[model samples]
Target: MATSISPLEVADCEVLHAIEQQAHSHPWSLPTIQSCFGGLYHNIGLYEANEIVGFAIVQQVIDEATLMDICVSPACQGKGYGKQLLKQVLEQAQHRGVKIMMLEVRASNQAAIALYLKLGFTETYRREGYYPTESGREDAIMMELTLT
Candidate 1:
């Protein structure tokens, strides 16, 4: 399996959105994904055999970066690809002089929460009824990692 991580361009938005739809229950719209290009955003793609398997979107503002989104193809999940992608993103952010990384995850997503914890992120707080759910709204756990 030939795998590589590279910076992603706006041209890859369709692919990113497709993977997002596959991996998330309520994925971001294509327009939303496309709008992340340029400026403060730094996106990366995880490819295997020259095909995209996962991706992460991060936005930096001075010393802080927010992990806006990350998703691995459902077909490629549970094989450590998500962790690999996140690790690469974190490294890149730190190299770019970012002092802190932050992200929000659905409170119901135990797998993602565990992954974040393994990556050294601590729960800072929670926003009640932050994300919409089938039944109603769900809380969003805010996690942060101090890279310095």
Candidate 2:
């Protein structure tokens, strides 16, 4: 069992891309993923059996951190991998001295919202017309966690 987390390398782009594509209906572009590890943010990959299983991207601005993206491979979803990944990411952020963690999820993504709440995040506000939806725009529910 190769369950471990490592700082994502440029070489891990393909795996992250694959996981993103598989997990999101509106997947992020390759350039966006590359930009995450391009010196502006911190990115981590969850590896198992020498392969990537999930990833989290976080951008730090002073004491605040924005969890830009987090996703588990479609095949790995519902197996507690997402939970583990989220906990690890939060721990890492706290260890880095980040005081707050925030992220936005589509209002319809009940699973993600539930997980965030279970992890101590509270709803902050809603961003109307924030994300692209099949029909017009979808509201984004903002969630925040205070590490300290």
Candidate 3:
């Protein structure tokens, strides 16, 4: 499968929303997703044969960058697309002189935490009850990768 990564724009929000809904238990509202199109945020889409299969949203401020969100289509999960997409984001951030990359993940998301760890991120701390869950609230594990 021929795959590619490309910068995404506001026009791509609907497609992103679709994938977000499929991949996340509590997905962002379309308007919330739409608000990330510009400014300090740089969004990217992962495509296979020119069709979007995943996406990531990252925000940069000076030397620090935060990975705000990432998702691969449920059907496309476990194929390493998430890793590829995240690696691309890291590369782009490094190219722009970003010194550190940070992110927060649900404590229950072992797959995501493992992926982050594999990419050199180290857990820094945790926020208890930071994310709402069906049962109650879940902790948010904060991780960071030093790029410089």
Compared with the true structure, model 1 gives a TM-score of 0.98
Global lDDT of model 1 = 0.95
Residue-wise C-alpha lDDT for candidate 2, range 77-106, written one tens digit per residue: 887777888898899898989999999999
lDDT of 1 by residue, 1-148 (tens): 6689999999999999999999998999999999999989999999998999999999999999999999999999988998999999999998999999999999999999999999999999999999999999999999999997
The list of candidate 1 runs beyond 4 A from truth reads none
Candidate 1: give the clashing pairs.
none
The better-scoring model by TM-score among 1 and 2 is 1
- Residue-by-residue lDDT tens digits, candidate 3, 5-78: 99998999999999999999999999999988777998999999898999999999999999999999999999
Q: What is the lDDT of residue 34 in candidate 3?
A: 90
lDDT of 3 at 10: 93
Clash pairs (backbone) in predicted model 2: none
Give TM-scores for every candidate, taking all chains together and pairing residue i with residue i: 0.98, 0.95, 0.98
lDDT of model 2, residue 82: 76
Clash number for model 2? Answer: 0
Higher-lDDT candidate of 2 and 3: 3
